[model samples]
Target: MTGQEAEELLREGALTVEGRIPDASNAVLYCSVSHQERSAHCVYKPVEGERPLWDFPDGNLARREVAAYEVSRATGWGLVPPTVLRDGPLGEGMVQLWIEPGHHSDQDDEGDGALLALVEDEEPGPGWKAVGFAQVGPGRTALLVHADDQRLRRLAVLDAVINNGDRKGGHLLTAPQSRLYAIDHGVSFHTENKLRTLLWGWAGEELPEEAVRVLRHLERDLSGDGELAVRLAELLTAPEVDAVRARVAELLRSGRHPVPSGDWPAVPWPPI
Candidate 1:
């Protein structure tokens, strides 16, 4: 079916908004049965006429985000699983797996103090590890679900190269066991545009071998009829996939170890 038909399907659901939330776009808590055999956590977005209070220009914002998440899912990366996009009674919507909030240290807060922390960069540790305040729990508190901070750190760097422009601390979630996950990727890989993000601090350094392998595979798959391109096409335009291929090629050719330089946007920026 065409995009319009798909959206029509979403609009037929018995979806309702739970409330408005800050940070994220107009997306709000919504409930509706998803699969015939199961239910899921979902969010709905309405046209501006329906939800003038919501800042998103249209349901396309939700579409952009869901597309980016699919890119990660295509790579077998666990940042976000593929989410179901559909039409709701109110408007277009999505039904996705819900993530429970992890425990936070005393510093984590949800108010203005928390938002301020995101733009305010501070060294979380030595070795160039700067963390966004979102990582800080309520009132600048830290979360206890401590996955390998280093791995998450590396993933953040890759996120930047991929031009994932929405890796805000709030988007990087961890389970109680410290399993890292990233969410909200509405703006990514715009095909030859500056897909720059908050993770630019590692621009001059050699990429981790582990990351390079992933890129290498992606590079090869882009030219063939494989899952990566098929999956990417679901979210990105044909040109966007070409752009991703170019970026991966450029990075792989550098043959350098990971390091930071002034040329990149900024290290430890909130959404790198």
Candidate 2:
């Protein structure tokens, strides 16, 4: 289904919880939402199921997830799947269309693996960008690398603007038609800089032209009484909204991808 159609199903359909996702820290439910003749699987995270985090306020992760979707939609990249906040079986929460992982295409750019991989060589060869060295065993280390694909580059830019704090490798999903989607954005949009991620391959590189244009568009959409600004104000604090605007402005000013600040952990633990 198209993004709009999926969004409509999520918002207007009757929802039923199918089962719980066991691996998630917060309660994540596998569900099916149906409206008239259409139906699809979805993931729902209710506000009441959220575990308290020391850094973020309580009962706000669901809103932050939807806020990430709004920014992703504004970029016109569709990096995030269609997501919405509404009352579910558990309560008010974030619900997003489920994307099944597709088979690897014959045209896979990363060649041997998905977006990320580890190699014994210290440097990442062609078609790859080095993240850093990771310890594998007691005395062995492998070079961590990510694909040099434009899609991942755009996601890196998106993570920067959103202040995404936990962009683990597993969050990257390759759906059918080679569409790339990023999920699990609960710890995002903080007023402080907390951009911990595994996609630092483009650190210090000049921003892509498309990304520059997108950032310019975001600047307008986030300034004053712009539509995005108005919508985000309903989901996030005033300072968090301001911080997003500031991040976009900084990207425009720098014209380059950001490097780790060193004040906080650069990569999330267990990067995958």
Model 1: residues >4 Å from true position, as ranges?
1-17, 32-34, 45-59, 103-128, 131-148, 192-196, 255-272
Residue 188 of model 1: what lDDT? 55
lDDT of 2: 0.91
Cand. 1 TM to true fold: 0.65
The numbered model that scores best in TM-score is 2
Q: Give candidate 2 regions above 4 Å deviation.
A: 102-113
TM-score of 2: 0.96
Task: Please give, for residues 74-106, the per-residue lDDT of candidate 2 as tens digits.
Answer: 999999999999998989999999877452222
Number of clashes in model 2?
0
Candidate 1 local lDDT, residue 61: 48
- TM-score of every prediction relative to native: 0.65, 0.96
RMSD (Å) of each candidate, 1 decimal: 7.8, 2.1
